[model samples]
Target: MNKAIKVLAGLLVAQLLVILALQTNKPGTTQVAAQPLISVNLNTVDTLRIDDSDGGQVTLRKEGDRWQITNYGNQPADQNKVAELLQKLSDIEVRWPVASSAAAAERFEVAEGSAQKTLTFQTGDRVIDSLFMGTSPSYRRIHVRANGSDDIYQVELAQHDIPANPESWMDKTVLEFEGDILSVNAGDIAVSRDTNGDETSWKLAGSATDSTDPTLINTWVKRFNSLVVSALVPAQEVEPIIVQNPALTAHLSSDKGDADYAFYTANEKYYVKRFGSSALYEIASYQAKPIVEIEAKKFMLNTSDAEPPQ
Candidate 1:
């Protein structure tokens, strides 16, 4: 009886050990996860190419302080524009797979051979910038690899209302003036002054045949608006000898030519002069003061108050 009991105890001990060993050796219940697909660092990429689905490609290369389109004969690339593209790439956070429905698959082209694009980036060393595969009706999957890390992204061609043409953003009109005050000859004008009390108003002596012409005024206004104001002068210097009165005398001139004019707001009074030997040699000068300055004492106020506000 004693021997049978000892044998039973030995059997129980062996079974417990076996159970513990089997539990320890069995495969883990949780599965190991797959790695990500794309990664990149922008600062290191000196050269890169972005291929479009329409078979167009843009190649970017870093020049001295700027990036250039090397494939387009080394044209200058707007750095801010390229930075926006890089930001978009960096911000890609998701790459969901297309569904398996026939319409979905057809749209995504999953049955078709993978339309993959390989991007090569050259720093000091060459690296695969991105690998895009699989197409969808709305988007495509891009698998990117950079610095040995994986990033997956979904991309789609953005619909554009306007056609993509470089000329659309370029200057189209021939007479398009960009800067302030453009100067042109006004031909000729006769001048005189009307003096009433202490105040005087300068007037053109003849009826301007083209004076009320909208096109002429528009042309002159546009040109004058484009002129850059550099220095201001007193009215007496710019007026014709006959128009220059005892009360005022001064003028303004650009380093370039007399064809130009200056600008001032409507509330400001202006003294203008046309001077030259012939109508063709004419130039204009502009002098401005507050309209209230027509009052003698107010107009005589000097340079002391001209300083910029503190």
Candidate 2:
């Protein structure tokens, strides 16, 4: 009787030990099946590679507050555009088929040793990124590397199915030149002459200035307003002034002159004076000729122009 009791006690102790061992081993299996290896977090990455369908590739890196294309030795990159792409990638939720089934194997190619290329991403101690299974015939694939891993992405080119109206974005404001002429900032001058007896030409000057004169200020303000109110004309309206006599192009100018005008007609070149009461005088192209034309027409009309109101 005693021997039988001892045997029974030993069997019970052995069964308890076996149950504890099983419990401990169960946790390992649950952890292994909990998450996938390829999941990625898009926000913290500082570098990325983007490939297009045409076999072109771009690599970008973050510098200061901007992202630049570092693959070409530090070129500027469009950060806003890149951010939009990253957001799209993180939000994608793929519906992968079940493992081992024919449908799953065919759609995702998840089997080991598959032909498709896989993308990997790592940072410090974490791995994050995405994978591309097949090539998109029309669109190209882009690779992004952040932290320590690589991520693959696909991009498509937009089609021009809709026509765009070029004039839609133009400002329509108009300015009346009848008001006081503001200070004009003249740029470099080019002199030429025409064959005909009459001489006429055009000059370009930076329209911006710091003057506060009521008349000058009002004129520019109106001009800027007109530009905001009017649509720009097509390019066909531009016409070139004719140059005739090279001798007529001689003129004199002061470096400190407030305003400078290049006057040329079909036959002569004149450097006209601007600023002070004497500004109305036109400097003769030849030393023998006296000053001519006081206060020539100060303003010209533009049939087609546009700008924002001041």
- Note the clash tally of each candidate: 22, 37
Question: Relative to the unseen true structure, what is the C-alpha lDDT of residue 205 in candidate 1, on a scale of 0 to 100?
Answer: 29
- Cα RMSD (angstroms) for every candidate in the order listed: 18.9, 19.8
lDDT (Cα, tens digit) per residue for candidate 2, span 199-297: 122222322222112232233323311222122222232122212322222222222322222333323433322222121122233411221221111
The deviation in Å at residue 179 for candidate 2 is 26
Q: What is the C-alpha lDDT of each candidate?
A: 0.38, 0.34
**Per-residue lDDT over 1-310 for candidate 1, one digit per residue giving the tens place of the 0 to 100 score:** 9999999999999999999888877888443443333355777778766553455466677887677766543545556666765665555554443243445433443222232333456774565455433333353433222222223334532222111222111111211233332222222422222323111232332443323232322332343333222222333433442333322222222223333222222212333222331111112233123211222121122334322111
- Estimated TM-score for each candidate: 0.36, 0.31
Where model 2 places Cα greater than 4 Å from the true spot, the runs are 1-38, 52-54, 98-130, 133-186, 189-299, 302-310
